[model samples]
Target: MVFLAPKKNLFNLYFLRYKFIFLTIGLLFVYILLNGDIRSNINVRKCFSDINVQNKIEDILLSERKPRKGKTIFFHETSCNIPDTLNHVRLKARQACAIESAALTNPNLDIYVLFASPKILNNQTITPILESILSYPNVYLRNVNLWSYAADTPIYEWFKDGKLFKSKYIYSHVSDFLRYLTLWHWGGTYLDLDVVMMKTIENIPPNFAGAESIYHVAAGVLNFDWDGFGHEIADMCLRNFQTHFDGYDWGKNGPGVITRTLHEICKTKQIYLMTRSRCFNFNVFQNETFYAVPYTHWKYFFDSDYLERTLEMTKNSIAIHVWNRYSSDTPIIVGSNVAYGVIAEKFCPKVYKSSGKYF
Candidate 1:
């Protein structure tokens, strides 16, 4: 009985001495349970370390909402060359300039820049130019599946059959088809990535496009209303896209389809005559409004001497297509007095400033 009493006293004294340490451990456990992040333990952290996991998360976060048909401005990135290191779509300086300019010109409209291939975005992947454009509340960046984008539309079969991939000019042809599909699915203003908005297009006729020449209407700058005849034009263009698709002729599917459709609709060879004509439901603006500096004079954009002339020519232009096909190889030296440099500096200051030396 004496030995038992001594052992009991010893146990009681030891428990009392360490009671505060036990209490702290229990409280920490309760806190970990209360905080939901405890659920995101080692497994979650390990999963997030995978690039695909991060990409899927970003994809959902950046997904596009149902766009306002008439009020959305659409630009497409059809390239699939996402570098292994960069899972996000990286736009060139000129392309970023185009998007920012559109946002600047039409602050009320939603500007959508969709990528055809799946992209994973993170703080590291987003470049300064992309980050700058994303700062605009009206601008949205989304990764889109080309097949899903064309689904249920008349061009679905064509896209599914992989006809777009078999083209000699695959990227360009994909862009053309995607533009029509975009219009058919969600009617809106579709601009080529190379086209920079110089003025607000809010006042322009809802169903209008710029003429590339007296003979053909350009598809670079296109606006189709959400409903009524404009929608009808989009539908017809999709049908024509499928019916008259020719991978051999470069322009057959794009400019060719639009021009042919307009001729049939207006039943006039002189398509330019219908400009701003209230009698017809659709209008075509002069080439000077969009293609003021034509492809032939593409070099003028980089020439310092032509800066004043370029400004004068584009004074009345609502948008300018710098003919990326022709001028993409040409570099705009930073701090130069070239026309493109001046225009980009004023319209897309962030991208211009972020571009280190040349853009």
Candidate 2:
């Protein structure tokens, strides 16, 4: 009889032979799953200059006609590492709620929700949340190219040199820069994605930003028209951003830039005095107008016990900055007695109802 040799375990033999490779691939796969995107910091760096990259934005300065009625309200969605998973264009419930609140409250005011990438718009899928947001005739979703956006602006060189991706808070810093650039170019209202519009803001001062506190003037809700005082404020912000840009520090480039500009323009160290426009014409609204619930107590919006008190506190607020930095991880249960839920139900009923059990 022929010698019957036991069959070698080819799979185990191969695995053992390339165990290091397998381990590396396994770790990489796990990382992608955990991080939701596999692109490295290097890829982010490449994308900053990659014009061929599919994600792009339309030049609103060229395409969109100036609104004939109320001034345009702007909201920016910036993501450097966009995952290929479902449509990123589909706004999160919270984001949709925020947009819908603004759209519903200010029907006459043109609301532009600009995305940093075009992938979401290019996708064939139109998600429910997206449909709800688009239902508002005043609401428009457009893609924006950073290079094109920064072009003709003071920060153009900074972006051309690829310094934006170096920031630890890349998304926030890019947004901080874009807000000033867009406001400088078009002169409009810029609202943070985390804010919920409680009332119409079209009647508010043309160039205004709310103070998060006595010491800090938040950039979350900013309005700077393209000409006159608003133009002056936007110009100053662009100069300040270019003159003193810090990538490492979180707030330095954002609220810090605006705070510093306001200080210089108003010629005062104390921000509380800016509320009265003591030194300059730029209107600095009290914290209650936008930051009714300060960042330190942002959790109050999510707490059922504080729902009534928070609502009562923000009754006169034109908008509420939910301080997404502090309260994003906290869930807002649908139909719950939380301030966020109640506010969403009243202001963004469509988004709130579509959020199912949890928002």
Candidate 3:
């Protein structure tokens, strides 16, 4: 009787163990089937991983630049860890370079380049470009160290506490914040590196606030009034940055946030948003019929075939933006050729007679 009882107990225990193993296996299989290959991808995992301020800035600084060779332009990607499935960084770099080249054409202008990099030591290749740009009277390079304050915080704590944020959010927030700050301290224009200046922007009226279109406040180019409203706008942007801790989609949200805030403040203060005849590009509400130019006007600015066609259509545009379709192999040679020809023939006749340098 005792032997029979022991065998029965062992059999029941073995059966229960097998059942539990099978149940666990079934649940795991179901999870994998439902989630696809998501668990296997490390990039997705890293996006949600805890990151410290120093580490975050380090990643942003280390992101690959296109051409692997050449002057590093005035723009740096925010380290948002958004999947680079489509090579978005390459596109941004190309667009930035195009803007830099275009901005360099004006002799009287000063180009200010802003970026956040982990490494404090200046890059060798970028040094020459900075030196070259600085040769002109007004160009300046400013590196804003974003991680200086929270360097000692742990990665996990920083992420959870909102001390660490994605790069895009930081960049957009900082840009808007700095724009207002600069105006409050010393007034000047805040030009998005994406914009190309077709005329002397120095002539922008002191009281004027520039916008691309009325419906869309083209943040790419802003000439602030720098008195009452400008100060308020800067303060609001800074406050939002400290509070939101996310939502930094530059293409969509950055300008939208600024415009909405500015509009609200303007209403309360009884300050009307001004619409200039030809000074700004984004104003859509002007009574006088104005021309709306495509961003491709800047992209194809240097392509001989495209330039010829564009010149025939509108010979005098102050600026054009190349929004997308930017790449390292962007036809700079072709574009520069057209630019030189146009500058010599129309805008600045002395371009050829001066330094006569070609990149």
Candidate 4:
């Protein structure tokens, strides 16, 4: 007797036919979810300079015309070995204060603090210190990873082809590179975790960077729009980074990258660097207004003299980078005489009160 084939429902028929294909897809989905985007692998090496993050900001400078209204950004690169441990609590809190201060002073601006890893955001309960920062109405948080910071831009593939940070160099260099890429992707201010806003940044230009000295432009406080100098400068800087890199010199990738790129850009512009008032596609802020505290004396921010000399500097300064490199282990005591303690109480009173530690 011949047996007849059973009629099957459409769903069952399709499922039987595509079972192997569906299994393969399901496995891939699980792999991606468990491992994250392949583009994010740190070793997926790319030269810092040559990677194309996005457009050259200079070409779009004035042509870009205007920036999206109200934008400021901060990057917290915890992945580069910077953990939120007790030893680092005050410094992290101070960084949070800087962001909150900016948000409070400039209510019109949309301030963002991008955490490089989900470690902090993933925590079920963030430390009380972080509470002060999260309380701000204007401050917002984003979870960015290695891939998100530089991926899907003009140079995502190029970067993935080459190695990024070196094992020998301090991981902060990784942060330095990410800041440049993030700024290139989205033109806006990029603040180091060390900064503290003293006043409203109402004067920040559409495409602008601040100078730490006549020869060096500090990347600590930088801003730009996608179509303007921000992109142009970052693109050129990344290229220079590929050609001239010194892992031993920490600044080589940070301030040095921008300073070296400025020379190349200025040469093309054929404008004299005299008077230090040189104009580019966007704008350049001078040292007097930007670098109120020179690198040599960054430690003063933790001393008592800050009440006098430091405040004097802020007269023309937009913010201060307390140089936490020298003070990461330092604590900000309540009702203490330290400069950082004073600044903390003034800018992040809530955090200071939450500390509940007399020491």
Candidate 5:
């Protein structure tokens, strides 16, 4: 017993010799925990020789929240309903400009362009426009099938040509479904092929959708994360997509779903101010900063008289939706003094170069 007591005393004495060092380390850890500056003071030493203090400190710092590194990314995708006629849907220079504008404006984002069609892949043709988009390091093009996006859901087979009622807008409906699936599962920004980015997308919190008009939240620009209310909204929309789906109605799948979901989330049918964005879970923007020119005024993009006015309006907007459906048939004159020409020249010089004077 006497020998054991002496040995214990000897061990205590050994530890007491570095008591000041141990106390200093404890204080340092407390300071690090309190102060959010995790990037500083990485050379601190620990009293114990076996401890890898730096790695332990890193783990602790990362445990607070998901460590988000690098510039924020916006996810985008497009679907060609008639995959058999992929050549008709090959990426055009204007569409390429939409992607280029996104990458050029943000510079940090990795824009993902998912092509949702099986038949398109069978006979692949890379147009000059697609070649230009492929050159960007940050832009990625991928294949995403309908079953791949909504395979497990109830409305999985609804995408089949013969399964649903025939309509001219079936392709558009499928696009809406794909956007929901993409944002729900992947969780990032979704831009229409017609939209062009004008400014950096920053400061906005996650899980947000925007309204182009009163009670009309368009799915063209949807930004969300995989966590929190994003997944919930997606789940709600997908489930309802199974229940209240209509192939005959044009807006039923796109804007209609958004309006219905908004009502479900807010628990009201009253005309709420979209500008205020007082939803319970996430926010919805109606302010023109999100979409300067509404889809109805899409022709203004190609009109020479509205060129000066459009340019003035675009300064405040983060992006402009060109409403390709309305303006797709119109030719873009590179130097004939139009808003589209001016926008193309400034935002995407490469695309403009291809268009030249008469395209």
Candidate 6:
């Protein structure tokens, strides 16, 4: 009986051990299925990073309940191929002038320009732009060294389809630009040089955070809530850029990475996407108000006249943005008649002279 009992006891112990092993294996498989390998998936990683940043930016904004009274800072960075001479200077100057005029109309607000470190040229033009900004107490210039964080070679060169992709400098420029904002403005509006500030933006809603609510606002006409999610988004973008540095060269892949990141981060926090009414209209002028248009709607961007008509009809627009077509020298013209032409002339008279003048 004693020998038989020992054998039975051994059998029970082995059976229990096998059961436990199976249970552990089953749990592990479930975890893998549920969570997956997020880091390995570029899209997943991008989304994760974006959500992380949005939360951080929201935390910052929520902490500062009061409206920031400091000067509105307009920021920009120049890369190697961008012209620093006559044409480029004129375009940049026009943008600055438009913003400065808007600021002058509103005495309570000041506009300042922070010139990021010039990669293509020496610091010579920086002085002139600074001097020009000096005319107004609110308008000023500050230089930032973004190259410190940038990899020695462009991120695209490290990837396979780098040749097809553009905006390689976006990640690096945005990082340095935000860093300067933190140091100088702490919590202020950061306007893109290509954007034209149409109206005074003295009281941006605390929840709005200056980013376009409906469609994502272009980084160009961003309003940093200092307490908002700009920093977090910027940080996540940088990290993702480093991780999927090779994948960025795919056409639209880089921005796609950014968009995914923004959406994911915003979703996790339950931070509602900013609606068009909450922030400025992202694109299109309809019913006399700037409306948010999706990025995919680029095909509808007929020309400057079409944009101008849209602007004229828009009721409340914080700013008008001219993105994507930044590299083209000619005025963006679209449409096909006197009715459209009249509206276009109201905003941009020069469009009348373009090849598509009839349209």
Q: What TM-score would you give candidate 2 relative to the actual structure?
A: 0.83
Please give the range of 10 consecutive residues that has the lowest summed lDDT in model 2. Answer: 48-57
Give stretches of model 5 more than 4 Å off: 1-89, 119-126, 153-167, 270-277, 356-359
lDDT of 5 by residue, 263-319 (tens): 877766543443235565577765476667888788888899998888887777777
Off by over 4 Å in 4: 1-70, 80-91, 120-124, 268-277
Clashes of each: 0, 5, 10, 12, 0, 20
* Predicted structure with the largest TM-score when compared to the true one: 2
Task: Show the colliding residue pairs in model 2.
Answer: 57-143, 57-144, 57-145, 58-143, 187-226
Clashing pairs in 1: none
Error of 6 at 258 (Å): 5.9
Off by over 4 Å in 3: 1-110, 118-128, 147-164, 167-186, 207-214, 239-250, 265-292, 295-304, 312-315, 324-329, 334-359
lDDT of 6 by residue, 83-153 (tens): 22221222243344444544554446655443332221233444343344445555433333333222232
Q: Which stretches of candidate 2 lie over 4 Å from their true place?
A: 1-42, 45-70, 83-88, 122-124, 275-277
Between 3 and 4, whose TM-score is larger? 4
Q: Over the stretch 1-359, how does candidate 2's per-residue lDDT look in tens digits?
A: 79754557766667787998889999999988756433455566544332333444444645655433227888888775444332346678998888999999988788988766443455456677777887889888776777787888777876677666667788888889888887887787888899999899867767788888888889888888678777878888988887788878889888988899888888886877885347456788888889888888988999999978998999999998888888888987788899988888999998888877789
Provide TM-scores for the models: 0.81, 0.83, 0.52, 0.70, 0.70, 0.47
Q: Write the per-residue lDDT of candidate 4 for residues 1-359, one digit (tens) a residue.
A: 99766666766878887997999999999998757534334432321221222221111122333223326565554443223221211225566677777777777766766544333332445677677777787666654455545666655664565445442453666777667776776666777777777677766556666778766778887766765556777677666765565657777878887677766666532212522345465555676555677878876766775667776766677677777667777665678776667766777677667766631
After superposition on all C-alphas, the RMSD of every candidate to the true structure, in Å, is 19.6, 9.2, 10.7, 15.5, 24.6, 15.3
Winner on TM-score (2 vs 5): 2
Total backbone collisions, model 5:
0
Of the candidates numbered 3 and 6, which has the greater lDDT value?
A: 3
**In terms of lDDT, which candidate is stronger, 5 or 6?**
5
Encode model 1's per-residue lDDT on 1-359: one tens digit a residue.
35455888999989987997899999998898756443433222222222454554233223446678799999988775423444556789889999999999999899988766566667777888888898899988776666556778777886667555556676688788888888876788999999888899977768888788888888998889888888899989988988888877789988888888888888776867765554266888888889988887988888998989999999998888888988899888889999888888888888889877998
> RMSD, model 5, all Cα superposed?
24.6
Error (Å) of candidate 1 at residue 47 is: 24
